[model samples]
Target: MKKFCFAVLSAVMLFGFAHTSFAEDMSPKDIMIKNFFVNRVKDSKSESAMTLINESGQKRERKSTGVSKLQKNGIDNMRLIKFISPADVKGTSNLMIEHSDGDDDIWIYLPALKKVRRLVSSNKGDSFVGSDFSYADVIGYKVQDFEHKITGSENVDGVDCYVIESVPANNKVRQDNGLSKRKSWMRKDNFVTVKGENYDLSGELYKVFKASDIQFVDKENNKWQPMTIEMTNVQVNHKTIVHFSNYKVNTGIDEGYFSQRNLERE
Candidate 1:
């Protein structure tokens, strides 16, 4: 009887192993697409605190309110951010409209200038408001613009993750983002990126990203969101820590709220 029980256990274990292996056989592009879909929210509103620390330990903090809504076509996201704290940056705002097939639209309003300006540049790698994060970091890289391959698998914070390496498909794409390649450790279960390393044109590590404090934002949908995200510039020794709070999902935000006219509205 003991021998029979052992045989059954071994068969179950073998079946489980095969199932896991089959799931992991997905291509890199498929994995990225899955990750993108898993992270997408219908609409969300939140307030966040961004702290920037320099090499010398000097610190600056900015508080902002953000709103994001998915477009009706379900292929784009419109986001607006309004700075509210620190007298120097108060009343400043930025709007980004990310599209599925083309370059994203970006606009900025500076209180000091008292004018709204549209940003039109080929370089999407520029630092965002003097923070370690770049424009690409905010809007995300388009999956179709790059080539992806699974390099290996590893454990991150006790979670199993698939390591994916992404490279631009052409010189134009590489020039636009100012990145030669990027490697990300995506959690196997949820497809969330837990860690990432960005390489520059010279193939040197430029920045590192880490996500933590994950929490369920929509239990019914089995949706998870990260409460804290950190990016560090390796060469400059600068770091930006973003903490999100007061998250409300599926808020039914008006599409017109993402317009440039609304960007300048008080």
Candidate 2:
């Protein structure tokens, strides 16, 4: 009886040590990679309302429908956003094809111009459709493009989070994104970013990003999606609030829908 009890105790101790070691071995980059993969779905469709508030508190609203699909090659994502309302911006659309190995491709169609123009990939730092969010913010910054380290841990909205600091991996990337550094608070349980701070070329706080009203879009897959995302430009006191609704995930979106031809579709 004594030998049997000793064996059981030894087994328990070994298991505990192994678990702790595994947790400690996960680096900040691993955590960020997990966060990136967990939040993204194979395909998604949603309708969203974007509200832009200027320095004087004046507000303008735009509504749009968006669809995203993982490319057939399984290494990239293609997304399309089509504006549906507001007289001036109606029929405006943007299409983005995100590549894992190279710069993303973006095309925008403006109803006023009645032309589809391909945007410079490096112009991702520019404001997205006059909103506080940059193009990079909308399509997401690739995890491999930066080096991340865990600076500390804190609580965001009562949830424990890992505070990670990320910087551009090289001078070219730094210039492309127009950001010196970025910091994000990622929830420990879900690996979702609850808040983020962006620094400009001068290393000044340029924008603040906050995600709230998280909901489980795929409970079976343990996937959580934010219902509301807001980006505030600290220097300009401009803000954009995006509220997502009618979210559908993994609904077999057609890959052809992300093409530039669709950008001009009325």
Task: Say which candidate scores most in lDDT.
Answer: 2
- Tens digit per residue, CA lDDT, model 1, 1-266: 66565455445333443344357577787777666655568889999999999999999999999999887655468999999988898999999998664678899998898999889745689989889999988877777678999999999999999999999999998999999999999998877898999999999999999999987787765567889999999999999999999999988898989987878875
User: How many clashing residue pairs appear in each of the predictions shown?
Assistant: 0, 0
Write down the lDDT of every candidate, Cα atoms only.
0.84, 0.85
* Model 1 RMSD vs true structure: 10.9
Per-candidate TM-score against the hidden true structure = 0.89, 0.89
Regions more than 4 Å wrong, model 1:
1-24
Off by over 4 Å in 2: 1-24, 73-75
Query: What's the CA RMSD of model 2 in angstroms?
Result: 10.0
